[model samples]
Target: MPDHVWWKRGVIYEIYARSFQDSNGDGVGDLAGIRQRLDYLAWLGVEAIWISPIYPSPMADFGYDISDYCAIDPLFGSLDDFDVLLEDAHRRGLKVVLDYVPNHTSDRHPWFAESRSSRDNPRRDWYIWKDPAPGGGPPNNWISNFGGSAWQFDEATGQYYYHAFLREQPDLNWRNPDVRAAMHEALRFWLRRGVDGFRVDVMWHLAKSAAFLDDPVNPAYAEGAPDNQRILQVNSTDQPEVHAFVHGIRSVIDEFEDRVLIGEIYLPVERLVAYYGDNLGGAHLPFNFQLIHATWSAPALGRLIEEYEAAIPEGGWPNWVLGNHDQSRIASRVGAAQARVAAMLLLTLRGTPTIYYGDEIGMTDVPVSGEDIRDPWSLNEPGIGVGRDPQRTPMQWSARPFAGFSRGRPWLPLGRDFQTANVETLREDPQSILNLYRNLCALRTEWKALRVGAMKMHRAEGDLLIFERAVDDERLLVCLNLGAEARQAELPAGLGRWRALLSTVSARNAGNNVEFEDTVQLHPDEGLVAVLTA
Candidate 1:
């Protein structure tokens, strides 16, 4: 394998801009604050940083509802601040990837404003607008992912516009050539600004069924599922025409040298692999989220890894994500002990891993009361459990007031455990989760077998999961115990001797050379990487 593709062999750290750091005591993280912390990230050893949306917005869906695609929001700072960030990050050898929202725009955007003005407006076709049904109801029974009807009626024009999310975020009509050209131009605008790439938001939802049809009702939806789950969404998402649009976007990205395009797709593994396109023309990485949704068990995770590895198309590189702005933290999902196993699993797997900001220090979800809920999905569809404010709380830097995230009150409340979980506190402890993550990253950088080597499952039974990563004569074994009780894995024939390189249980013979004859015992929730003796 070639050694120069930065995104393929290196790790990427995701920064939720508003929650990362606060400059000027504003309680909101900005480009300036991120620039101030570049040194810390450089020390953490990530090769690239993928920041959440920072475009000019009305804060409807936080920054996802973009009013202007080309400018930075004042809440995050001016365009000059972004330029300095890009320049400084390059100087430190970090590639910057910005979040690109192309499926929809804020209702206040100029295109949406003109499209909603009158029936005969020149820009009326820019957005998806349709007449009400025969009974004066919404055109169809489609439900928004956030909640309620996907159609919002306009009394002035005697029509309704379709929005896949909040009423404030109107879905753009990609069928329109003008809209396509405009969106492509927006991509070019940032490429010229020297961004390394884009993580396209809701990439699969860009194209809809040409024939407007109501989605089929899902028979398996449970009582507590989100309202949107009531329908199968077959007609509204992952349409056949979406691949052509992906190719169009890829064509624009190809104009820039060495830039990557990563898509945020929530489809199944079978459908997700298609986003890579034929001959690798689609997204550079479509983002495999199987691990995030799988059950927290060794058997389930082992099956998921096998399925994902089997699904990748030829010439397509794989990627993995454990947590992000939308999902619950891994620590909260599997408990503190298993989170170390999770870190080892993420870094040791044969793919590029994207680490969420606070995960390195083992941050848990902050509790959000009804009054403090900032996510529109949680507010609109109360009791469905779709709120994201808990996961998007400010980053904890120190044990000072506001967890050293800000001088003023944070936009969202900090977790109660931030005092002990902050970076300052964890950095001093040798066995802390932060140190384990640092060691894992360093191991990936130092060993070719751990970085780009092929992976093969050696043993997977009950709570024990074992895999081998090898390149030519060098081989390494990864053993993880996901259950509460200790387990022993019997060695296979002719495996030779092995030495412990690193262990999740920090005090357990770490970095010690050992010779195993027939079996190796693993503590509960512990993981270890061992090198084979020649």
Candidate 2:
């Protein structure tokens, strides 16, 4: 590993849309708002910030539908605001990685607008288009991630346009050399600016099957999953050709020093590791989401840890992600009592750890009223009860009205109980979860063992979680008592006197006695880290 792999050894805080902070009295969050809060983020001890899509869009998919890949939306702020954001972020030593959606563009995008103008248009091939099938319907039966057929009919062109997500978000024709060149140019524009990296959106969806044959039906979803259960073959989406395109992206990033690329993919471990490319050249890191899937149990987490360690590439940097914009916050996923323990695990894990924006304050998901629904997922899957609105609510900065997020009405409702779960209140209480995160990040930044160490999973028994983080001469043991009652974790032989480094509960260390198996008992939902005293 490079001595200064800035991204590998730091904490990345993710900020979501319509939340964060509103600079424009207009309720929605903008880049200028993020710039104003750069000091707060720097104080939080984060190394970088990963922002969700802020490009110009129709807001059909909440900024994921990019109408213009290179421009900041008027709703968010102007291009000057973005330049200021980049400058301020670098001044504070915080690198910025914006979300890049290359898989598709909004139907309202000029490229698509021109492509769909007429069948005879020169740019018609810029997007995926096909003639209707023999039955005068979609050429192939491929289902959209949201719902229904992936093909949308264009009466003007008398043809069907491919859309992997919403009908408004048409898939770009990557097969077209001009399309690939244009996308590369968009990436270059950002790289030439002071931006450090990119978090590629839905990367695997960029390559489609050349065959364009009808997908095989999914027996598991024969009755069909609640959303859109039409076509089951995701095989058509993730093709081997995708690797070549990712390598091309890597080549572009190679032109700049310290530029990183990360992808959002949720496949099995074997498939997920492939995104790293040959010898760690493709994406710097494909986000590992084990924490999101693991149940809050010692055994479940233990198994996941082992699997993750085994799955990483040789000499490849590993990354751990607890929560992001798409899923529910970790605090809400695991109960409030267990929030601190989750933080300990995240900070101690041997990789770059990403914390969702409001997770430090133990923010819970807000309930969105039926009349206030903004996400398309809810409308697509009305009965299944899965949507992103709850996770994308406005950040709670203070107990004051609007939670200091906005002076006007917010785009989404703010989290309830802001008086208790807010930055202002938690900053005063040293034992608050907010303080725990701050201290953890500080320690992580200072300690090499917890930063770039190799992790070893120790014995996990009877609701006790144990692990070792080691790099060169430094070694530390981490144990967590996840059960309702206090319990002791057995320590390894030859382990001598240990000093308490960080703990959720009181810092009382019972020595490493062989008779007690070098153990210390911890209270319910408590976690502890101890470094060997030489």
Candidate 3:
């Protein structure tokens, strides 16, 4: 808890708890398993770990459908195990961020059960329950994120309750002051337990339109596209009033010392920065997922970076996300070679970087066959190729059976190349993607320019992107070749000499002082970090 914010400079590693490790000889990963792997994470040069949900749940949405806000699930471990894990992580100089799911609660939860038991129940307003339409259909045309109508009819109550993802997960009524106090106490409970921070799940979906209006149809939606995209969700999401609740959450976080609040918002850069709130009262960081959805070309990504850098509020901090449990792995989105380049860019960008679990070792999407699919989103909508099971496969720890993830049968299947693409195997290879990530992370920590300096895009076109990181007189240039063809990039003049610092191409390329020729040549899929010296 230094004066300098750790969230602003530290690299956060996302550990999908289920896929990370299984210490109890069970098929699934647990909190103890994550604690066991802390040494490896410390060696990986990450300063924080953002763990996915381990809260008490019905597992309807893979821990996203939380049943209890203040307790850990028995499947993961008990509260004592969690406290022990938190202590170990903090002892290793790592901050632990929990996934906060406030938008919905499992229908099996006592609160929801009581809310649905009677029409005039005291806690009925805690959940969004609306009367059916005149024609006995859904209240409106709002769609569920998973699929189908957002409303689910309750035969017992003769009403429809709104669930954003699954029918089992009923959306909470954030407008209710009682609900606010309850959720805030949940946050305080964890803060009191010494938990470092929270990454709020579906933060943008917290406040819905009070008027219960129909969303406008999306003209761009096609015939076979996902049902959720059929409408623009103008009325259902990003409501201006959402900020008031977020401000309240910020006030709760401010009560604790040195704790961060990160919102999982998928909005455009314009709206994303707004989560910084009026006078920085909102989320400490509303995740910048633009890189996850961007086209992997140089000019396109460069413009995206420039636009995101420009869109940040005056004093707001920035963050970048390349991959996550929900999105396609970077190695699969771009080619395997370019994932190395992506690692360099992710670490060098003028923002905090959150690295997905297996991405450092160049893990790609492990295809899930018909019989093995576990994601409800895919099971709900079969053949659109939108299943997330591919990305949530077990982490490749070593070349052993089950990729050393577990001794028991894995809950999910391992990747095809699990024997070769693993941390234990790649960590020893100096030229491997894992080492490239280690080196880049080390460089980011070693240089103030890379850690917290201003960034300027010098050249961004075609297959080459060149940017400079500077703080006062200390300067560093980053040159990236995104395509699979070698290209000569023009260098900025009067920057003194270029001393090669780090390269994704090879370990030998670093430390070779490339004399200024007004231009530098880069190999295909190469990214170089060079320091300018007098």
Candidate 4:
């Protein structure tokens, strides 16, 4: 693999800034804290670190509502601290990817403040503002993803401003050339600071319908589903114009050699591939969340992989994700035992894989009660259970007070099992999840087949999932059992012998001396990668 384009062949580890570590004893993680832990990340064998949004904000939506794109939040650290973190990360051979939120900005952002001040203000067009409908309500029936109407009335101006999320976050009018140029400049700002790339937040929401038409009701929406899902969002999101806007952003990223543009798009595989804009003008990797939403069954997962592999554009690369800041932890979604299987599946896939922070140690979601809830979505819709606070809790570094994540109380409570389920304890246990992840990553680096290979589904029967990954002369057979009982997979004719390279049960080389004649047996929830020795 060439070192020039690292993202295509490397695994990405996501670090939620406020929950990673705290250096100032302020209960919130900071850039300085992240900088201090560079050695640990380097040892983890990840090629890059993708930090969640750290821009200056009012803490609305936990920094997604950016007030200043160029400045680092005092809550995270000063700009100088960020520079040091970037320098240190580069020195350790770990590329840094910052979260870029271009869809909306904090209502307090200077541009929004000026735009909302009056109808005739020069910056009024910077944000999506419009006149009320004839009946004196919001301009349209679009609903915010958080809850309630998408439009928030400004008493002073008597017009409503559109927001796809919380009212405090006003969507930018990407149709306006000024807004486009300003956002592009924001990209240049970080590139000038020596950052490697950006993970664009809500890239699909960057453009909306010019007609401001009412979104049609979703026929399949359940009665108790999220209010935003009640509508089909035809006009509000995934518009054709979004592709052009993404191309512009990609152009700006191209100005900086080797820097990547990773768009956060949650569309179907067909539509998702469109973000890889016409060869060279789209996101280098549009995050693929199929595994996150797929059923845990072996057949379901196998079909998803096949569909995703087939959908990629000729030259566009593929990516996979199992967990992230906004979703439930993999350990929670599947059982703790299955999470090991998940780790194996994620790392050995054909394209790049992104590992969520704390997943290496099998971190489960921390319970957050009503009073403890900090997510705007949970607060806005009290009974819906849509809050992301549980998954955004502080990382478990040790058994010490606050899990050694901070000297002070963590911003969010630590998980109940943190004492035993932490990096410190897991690092010492060779059979631990952390060690499994480290071994898998090291193997991926050492083997060309696992790093950059062609994947083909070999079998998907009952609870067993089997596949082959190959590069040039090397071929690997991966078998996984998603069931609670032992399962056997029959090898094809002419596939002579095999040696266990890695297993979820830490049974490496358990069957090294045994030459296969027909079938292989897998223990319950066991997964293994083996080399064909014929």
lDDT of 3 by residue, 64-84 (tens): 999999999999999999999
Judged by whole-model lDDT over C-alpha atoms, candidate 3 comes out at 0.91
Badly placed stretches (over 4 Å) of model 2 are 1-3, 222-224, 229-231, 506-517
Residue lDDT tens for model 2, 285-369: 8888889988889988888888877888887778888888878888888888798899999999888889999999999888886
Q: Rank the candidates by TM-score, best first.
A: 3, 1, 4, 2
List all candidate RMSDs to the true structure. Answer: 1.2, 2.3, 1.2, 1.4
Model 4, range 1-534, lDDT digits (tens) per residue?
A: 252268977889999999999998999999999998899899999999999999999998999999999998888879989898999999999999999999999999999989988899999999998899998999999999998999999999899999999999999999999999999999999999999999999999988989988999898998777888899888999899999999999999889888889999989999999999876589999999999999999889989999999988887788889899999999999999999999999999988899999999999988898578899998888777788999999999999999999999888989999999999999999889998899889888877898888888988878989898988889888889998898878876677787778888855544445345358888888988888887
Position 64, candidate 3: lDDT: 97
List candidate 4 segments past 4 Å from native: 1-4, 507-517
- Model 1 per-residue lDDT tens digits across residues 142-181: 8999988999999989999999999999999988989999
Model 2: lowest-lDDT 10 consecutive positions: 508-517
Each prediction's total of clashing residue pairs, residues at least 3 apart in sequence or on different chains, is 0, 1, 0, 1
Error of 1 at 159 (Å): 1.0
**Candidate 2, residue 89: lDDT:** 93
TM-score, prediction 4: 0.98
Question: Which regions of candidate 3 deviate over 4 angstroms?
Answer: 1-3, 515-517
Which pairs of residues clash in candidate 1, taking residues 3 or more apart in a chain or in different chains?
Answer: none
